[model samples]
Target chain A: MTARYLALYLPSLATDRIRRAEPGLPRSLPLATWEPFGNRRVLTAVDSAAADVGLRPGQALADAQAIAPDLLLRPADPAGDARALHALALWARRYTPLTAADPPDGLLLDITGCAHLLGGEAALLRDALVRLRQVGITTRGAVAGAAATGAALARARGDNPVVVSGIEAGVVAPLLLGPALRLPQAMLAELARLGLRRVHDLLGQPRGPLARRFGQDLLGRLDGVVGRRRVSIQPAIPPPDLAAIQDLLEPIITRTGIDAVLDRLLEDLCAGLRQAGLGARQITLTAWRVDGAVQEVAIGTGLAMRDPAHLRRLFAERLERLEPDLGFERMALEARATEPMAVAVQPSLAVGGRRDEAAMAVALAQLLDRLGQRLPVHRVAPVASHWPEHAVTAQDPHDVDPTVPPGWAAQPRPVLLLRRPAPLEVVIPLPDGPPSLLRLQGLAHRLHRVEGPLRLEPEWWRNRPNRFRRDYYQVELASGVRLWVCRTGLPGAPRWLLHGHLP
Target chain B: MPSAAPDVPLDQAAVLAALRARVTRLEGFGRAQHNLGAVPVCEGLPLPGGGLARAAVHEVLATTPGCGAAFCAVLLARTGGTILWIATGRDELMAWPPGLARCGLAPASLVIVRAERWPDALWAMEEALRCPAVTGALLALAPPPGGGKLDLTATRRLQLAAEAGGALGLVLRPDAACADHTAAVTRWRIGSLGAGHGLDDPRWQLELLRVRGGRPGGPWAVTWRAATGRLDLDKEATATGATRHAAG
Candidate 1:
């Protein structure tokens, strides 16, 4: 399929990010953000006020300081800027889910089939820029019949934001080669020395000499800018497996109204799943607020389910946490991570068809869904290992395979395992004798009986090169409490640790 | 008042009276009308069917750090399914896998959740008790420095949730003062009775502080063997050992 793209460039993204975050900052102030470069600080971004004072980005801080001494400086946050751009990409999902953040200051969107959704490409670009400006972000956008690279370059350099269909070469020919092609500074300087500055000059020249002189990068970038090569965008989030969208004429703020809308959306989503004979394990509900903000809540079940009431109840637990601005005018429910529904066992009067087990399983799933709000749930399954600590592991409870039996260790382990072995103060009679008294948590206990120091060596190949040997002993205290303690290090100077207990 | 009942037979009247007595005896909401064989330890309790009853809330008080955790964990191990363990305070103080295994519970069958606040821990415990997948839930809540006393209403909600889900709920409270006002079906004060004569027999001083619809007379000398996952009455040992013993 032929790809059409839209590239949005935020020219003042860094300053705009700062301004957006600190809305109270005076616009008249000459603001410049600098970042550390090697041993020096360089201006990474500048506001219009700073630019008017002859300050440019990438200039050394000392040079910029000499020019505008009153410039308000801030440390540049590249990560924060990238996050802001990514957030804008999510906001753009309302127009098209095919959106990607072009790091630092840009967003590349695939608008091939989505243009008509927002009237047209021209209208979409204008509306998008207007919305961004309203959010204090100054933006430049361009649409092209070719790939995202062509639109991105045009937005950065070309006077026209919209390139006419099928006139890619004509539109790209007039732009300066320096801005159009992303080449090394040395190579651009070399091209400038050769009096080759504009795209037309490079186009009119022999292709062989240019390719030989600059290697293939200059030609490759030129090919990309003219639609000869495709440049695709990798979206931040994968599109939902199935989605149900609802547009409301009037926004709803009341809990009952929002819940009703969500209930209807869940029913619609369940209907789709029923038709496909698939159930979703994870469900996400998004509420698009009237103030151009998106609020989303997600829930996951240990088992696949399409029951609308059950899904609604799970969402009901989370609904109070979602604070909508004013109210939400649109809502979307998406089903992700779907699996085939397990065929329900028909209840028989004779055998009972394992009805009790099935009911119990269902009830457990419901309980997990309710408890999922405060904490995550995991299934504990025994693993095939001799080491007491490594004998069992946590698994997703939904992945229940009845044929695979749990593997139990040969040795008996303690009832409660400490997160880590805690040291116990014990008094040993001599170099090799068992401890007569153990002190733990400011209390002393008389050791009643002694057990063998069942020595277990470390799996040196799997762990650190030098590891200590473990000598485990099950000791009974005079208070009737049984504890599992272990000795580590050499036989002569071993440290005792209370590892487990028989509670 | 006599005009409407004049035609009733004497035998029918006697039968009705017997049924009413049975209903009154089984009035506790958490008392198991069925599935009595599911948990054996409850049989020692005064509840109907000679058991502690499934789908009920039980309170265990532990004066020491490790004792209550061990007792509740062993009891939960008796139930065959996932156990949700909600721990309050600095959760680092709670026991992990090997200790749980020694208590006869498979480490894989236990889910540990740490709630920093005691109230959050209680809420999570109630939520977990309402989940059918959780066969049993144990919450270890130390009395908060400020407002940590758990009243009857909070426990009643947990009781209802446990009954609804047919799951047993156990609360490990470190506060002994709030024991009498609890809404739990049974409240037991458990402390270490020290070591027994054998390898697996660990004795505990179990004092049944309160029991609804039954006699509560513990502070009994009982030996708990992890292998059998049951509490054995130590008849030879006198209950006098629990005289100085105290648990929350």
Candidate 2:
């Protein structure tokens, strides 16, 4: 049995309200639609009357009005049109997952496997048309083996829907003519003069002559229409299952209402997460305004969480930061799973259980949210070194090994540590002993009980050159105030400085 | 000198009591589990048992360029489990050593967000701190206008958020001076030390100007070996020993 390929097109279908409202405008009245421009407006669509009167898009509004004094102009709302198209796309999804929008006014659905469910190709087309007409949408549909052929036939052919059987190469080869073939007007006129008006007339001609006269693109388009070439269509990204949405009968204005709606959306989002047996560590909530602008609030968690109340509270903290404007019509919550969480299980009672790390992480996250990034304590690990500055480092509490040794247990270290030891002039009362009187930062301090100097040397294998040596000392003043002081270079190197003190 | 009587080991009950007391003291030192090690803005700090200081803010202010701001930032960032490094204007303000990664900071976990302006950077820092999921510390360069002093109210708000979030915030103030209004728990000045002799280690000096629960002022000499960016105290005896033996 010979196979038959069919492509269905829906033109003038008014998949969008803007296109449906087009025929309603008085034919004699000059009408134009304005679209949004940055902080202003620009013309988008112009009616035949308006075009006849010399009004075009991109012209200043005042100039357009002056050109067509009696023009009936309305502001174009692309967002509303997009929403309507999206709704139509959703509706078309029932027919085929391959359904997509052509933007502004068109939708394409590849109903390869779905036509039989609607009682064959003809019945499916009829059903679609009837459903659209019931919604006050004017539509025209055509079926062919090729997309381009179907689109052309739907646009140029009569209201009687066109249905072509067989593949494009065999069936649509003879039917292409006039604008359906998409040959330029001058080319079509020349073809008509040459007595080759129909695509069939040129099909039998030699390829060399066709290429010599017309461009390769024309032949390519013909090949595309005849299914000899492949075409790729960009599909929309699929939405995740964990989605939260709010539908309001009336637009919400006050912040309180917005908060309530957001809370409800979070609850739904949490429900979705629970249904998927997942938790969200990151969530973005979008407040879609009636004015078409969307305000988004995003929150990230330290650990995966699925609790609705916790999620709601996190969003509430962020919502307090937003200034709602022009009211919102819908609230959407998009939750993305971070790290996979383990399945929840009841704890066994045999062993003494410790606090859950996840709970602690959540508690810490809450603390971080309220405390401004400065409170969660982390341990500073000491590097094995003699230099006071290079010995210790800070690390996050979570990153720190609980089993690691404490910072102070290793050595009797100074209370105060300097970032870098400063150069100071010290007069040693006894040549090798501790300085009796030390001059540091323009101040003289009398030494009392002095400890031995602890020296630190630089690593030689490093690429950078080392210039000095340090000798750190723990000295007690007459008043019993202990200080951690250091001198740079060896004992005879001539440079000694006061580095830091023990607090 | 007369030595004390022979050391005696405490019984199990006494040891348990001592352990309890020590735990109590540690907890008391930091009322909030999150705020331990936080230095205060002023001096005369109350010392907890085991030499631990009470919970207070620690401010590290550096007047020199290209010091240990990055090291301190890495330290501060770890407080929140993760860290958000908000950089504005300058990129190389903080120098993070590789040793910090081994010290408990996961370098990959550090979120470095570059902002266009200081205020925006501050705002991002504030937001990151407010995010519970971030579970990270906030490290931001102080605003250019405040000298070394951040807005008290802003700092207070951040402190409150850090308290609430249990995240530590460390502000790297390059070339910042000590100001009376600055609300940082402890203010410190850190700088790079002169390189040591041949086959020696790199040295650094840190000055604590204001410590909340500890004493401030005076400098501490530290050595940073390139092999392990870890910091060590540069003691006088070590210097004398190295000189005597000609081996460091």
Candidate 3:
């Protein structure tokens, strides 16, 4: 049996995504994706407006500026472009399950026997192109007999497809060798010097000399392009481990209806998770609106949990934030991240302190979830260090136990530690004594009493050169304010800084 | 303020006392329960139920601006578990992690929340107080404009929330006169006495201006010993004060 493949190339995937996201932007403006290349910035991708104005990819930003002063440049997001390509691949799964992403901006699909369902190869190609256009991406695609690489080359060359099989070479021969073969600039220059600009020019030469000069890569590519070699497309695996979808007969606009659907979906998902002995750490709810927009809300659990009630509560808080304007016709609940849940919690006779502690942990987790909605919530964990700032670290609440630090009572530390020591202008007695007055943020505080200069220096072996050597003092102002000040640098040119306060 | 007639019978008085006891118990005031348990503030400073109530609102007023925040931090450090510190300025509380550690609070045990206005700060505090995991919630509020949201109504909501969640709610108001009517169960005026001679402890004059259902005492000089989590009272100076007590 013969194979069939289709390759779609989106040259300006980054700019296309930007255009789709901001449809209000003027399309006539010359927009291009700029990327840092070596010591200079180069155009990585260009929109049709920029392309029409004769700006090409890999052109230096300075050179482009000389050509078109009105050229609008946006920093290219390569990662985001890749993600968009992957999403397109996923969307293509509606046509065929065999879809793979060709990075930077391309997708490959093994349409094989699936084209007939979409009314033959031409209809399928038209459907794909039309859908991509609706999504704001300009695409070029081709369907070839059995060569995946040939279809890719055909798309890249912007040529009609070789759909009739056995004519791959005929279709590829007349195309310029530089673009059709995707060769290096030096090789293309040499080929041009030899008056061999087209594939047909190279095809007329004897194989022996071509192998000796251009090496085996050219022959391999040629073989792959002409169906002599079978090049398979590796499809990306989809994630649907624990997901439930609900379709409504009519659009649901009310909160109650959405909540009901979410409740049913969560129950369905948790039932599957329970049967599989797994718990979800991250859950995402996507609402497919009637207006073709997708509204999504996501929540995470500190502990691996399969309890439907808890999951519903977490989603409930987030659901209020998701405004499904114009209503939604379908909703999907997916557990993006999951882990094995504890089979059973030990049952105590009276539900004693251990139970209370467990309940407290759960309460804290819920509080964290709610608090994190408005602002970030972090857990403070003690680190083994003598430097004040290095003594503790803020970590994700899920990763650390929110318990009191051990041996915290013995320390003589300030109530509030500054993220960094702030500088304080001081009126020192000058010959190495304590300051008589200190000024912070332009507020003068006369030092009524002064404590010792507790000289603390960074560990010499642990730290690099220019390690801080500070003489700390506890100073009290006449207005009854106590401050922690430090004197650093050499005694001849010492700088005074306020470190903290002892309330 | 007791308006009972002098001619009241003994049996009637006994019935009245019994009824009041029942009402107090039903209202959750008869129990010797403190919200976050209590910090060991020096002796002679009488605290009802042997310590401060856990599920109640307490106000700390700084006699001077920029003075009471440290005191509030010290009180918060004494309460174990995670603390939610909400203030108007985002960066205002960022500098407190290390200093909070020195004051016996696990430096990392706090979640700092920045709100743009007093109302938002008050709302965040109330919400935080209702979270059981948040054993303590402290709000450092700049004095609100008169008749603003930081009145009896707002503090009352905070009080109810703290009580419901069994968490302590502390409001630190610097550079503001105390409101005549507030829902706070206790109010303390804090003034710094400054640090002592070389190697001496930091001192503060704590005045227990008002306390609901208990005696208001102090204006007492207390030295906070950082090495050990305890408050040392200046016994000789405190002896001159006339004792005043009120029955709850």
Candidate 4:
């Protein structure tokens, strides 16, 4: 036997007045609505009474009021309407796994093999409508062999849910109305002018002429509704593993209780991961409150981890942000994109060396998470320059250059290096050369021994016009203290400053 | 703070113990020799025999504003782990050492912690080192001290924390006078060697005045080649001469 699929369509579900009825206001009330405008109002919707009195949407609210003084008015709320539609869609998920929202106020359910459980297609439709009405939502459902057929049948006629099955889609294609074709109003008008007012009228024409006259869009819509074309629903988010949910017998608000529940959930999630031979790098914990609101907290790890203890520790830090307002009734934990851990094979004796790099990386990641990147550790290298300040640069620790030679500082260099060599007021005994007396840091010191007139010309290409030529000298103060100073200009020139000193 | 009574010997012991404990903790359940692959940089030190300084804290004092303080900090940080560069005093003077990229220290691993004042900068540096999970290095540029009592007890406490956490600490003292007493295990003065002819690289002369277990007074000249970002020892450049001066 061939398998059968049923497409269930819900329509007229998103109207605001029909939705806002507390017990949802009686559907019989004359509901007129308006939205805010600059010192004016624009009408949004009208109930059966107001519609009968010619109070259509987009009419002025003042004119609407003048025409019907007793009209019950309410503001249009698109967000609230969307939320209600979303909730209804979730509720519809009980009937099938492929249920999706049609937006504004409709739901599409691909009840492929689920109809027989509720008796038959008709019975399923009736059961769904009945449940919706009981929840204060007046709904209409149509079940057809295909989604387009069901949508067309549900919107074309107000008759009880249509159940068309077993026939080829083309045979019943003519019965669908113009609006059921789901085309824009202008295109519909053009089709109407061409005398192709309904699906049957459009389908009877030659394919080549129809495509030439009304365009492929009209033909495409016709083909789509009759099952000649395929349409796929793109889900907002991909489904995750272990969609486990706990419905509380009572609400829970305490942090300890929430943490306990989380612990249990994490264990279950970990068990699911282990069973699948995988680990999760990120986990999201959601708390569903009694008032139909949900709060979610997500924690991500540096590496894929399956340990429940570590997962718990990560989540514990974020628990304070998940306040259980009005008490939480349900908790859910989901693991996404599980993959097997990449285990490394032991190396042979021929390739002997330390294997601590990975461990160090993991430790570094943990430290980064805790400290938030405040460590000033980095790799340093000597920059090419005669100027002391430009001689070296700092790099990151993780980026240690393997190519650079080590232990290259065994020659004579000042242990106490200055960032910028400072100038000094020096009193030289002779006509040229190193200073004998120097005044620096507001103190006078006698120079005992001095070395170098290491002159470095400024980097002319750096775009700085007034760059100085420095002459550096390593001077030993009278107290056995060594200092690194630089003289600007020539050996006999006046510009000089004391830059750095040894410790 | 009377210079903390010059507890160099006690400080060394405490510092070494702290470093050993940190290395052990970082190594976790594995034996020191077994986990030798974990910290390749510190692997040069033998296990169970002071594997690595728990958290080695040293001071680099320079007279000039733009000396190679940041460069030394970067080296220490890259070798140690994560690095935090705390810049105090003038903004222009405090910068990342050049050629840092060639050394493997990227911007992501090097964190520049900015502070307006010296004391605050020191405090911030201490706090950064206290985090155990950080397992990195802390480098700060301090202002010139006005008195002889440069007892950084709070800094010592922070160093202890860093040791416990398995990190290294380096404090860059800028524009401070050279004194007879110091709390650091190693103290060095870096300056420029004599200029070379055209096409020859600039040579840097480093004088190791005070080292915990190493000889002092020998000047180490290193030639910094800009194009390659590498430091080379210039063995030909000998120390000029030492004119001994009597201590006051």
lDDT of 1 at A28: 85
**Most TM-score-accurate candidate:** 1
Task: Give the best candidate by lDDT.
Answer: 1
- Candidate 1 vs candidate 3: the lDDT winner is 1
Show model 2 residue runs off by greater than 4 Å.
A1-46, A50-99, A103-105, A109-245, A252-260, A278-355, A359-503, B1-29, B32-55, B67-148, B158-171, B174-178, B189-208, B213-248
lDDT of 4 by residue, B1-248 (tens): 57766655677788988986676556432234222222222212222433224354555565443335524643454454456666665543445333333243443445555565556566556656654434445455555442123464754565565555555566665535544455454565655443344122444555556644434554555654534545565555543323221221
Per-residue lDDT tens digits of candidate 2, residues B153-232?
76766655655554556666664443545665556676644344422343455566665434654455655443453455
> Could you tell which candidate, 1 or 2, scores higher by TM-score?
1
Report the lDDT tens digits of candidate 4 across residue range A312-333: 7667768889878879877887
Per-residue alpha-carbon lDDT of candidate 1 for residues A328-411, written as tens digits (9 for 90 to 100): 878889896798877541122224657766766676676666666666555566555556566556676554422223445335
| Full ranking by DockQ | 1, 3, 4, 2
Winner of 1 and 2 under DockQ: 1
Report the CAPRI category for model 3: acceptable
Cα miss at B137, model 4 (Å)?
Answer: 1.9
| Residue-level error in angstroms, candidate 3, position A352 | 6.0
Better-scoring candidate (lDDT), 2 or 3: 3
DockQ of each: 0.37, 0.05, 0.35, 0.10
What TM-score does structure 2 among the candidates reach? 0.49
| Candidate 3 residue-wise lDDT, A1-503, digit = tens | 57788878887788888887777878778888899999999988888889898999999999998888888778998888887787677667556667889776678888888899879988898877886777678888888875455454655577535366778777777777765666788888987988998877877889889989989998777677767787888787445468887878899999999999998999899999988878788888877665445666889887777778878877776888777777887788888888876522212322666776666666666666655666555666765556666666677766654454555323444554455678778887867888998887688878888877888778776757776788888777788777777899875788887667666
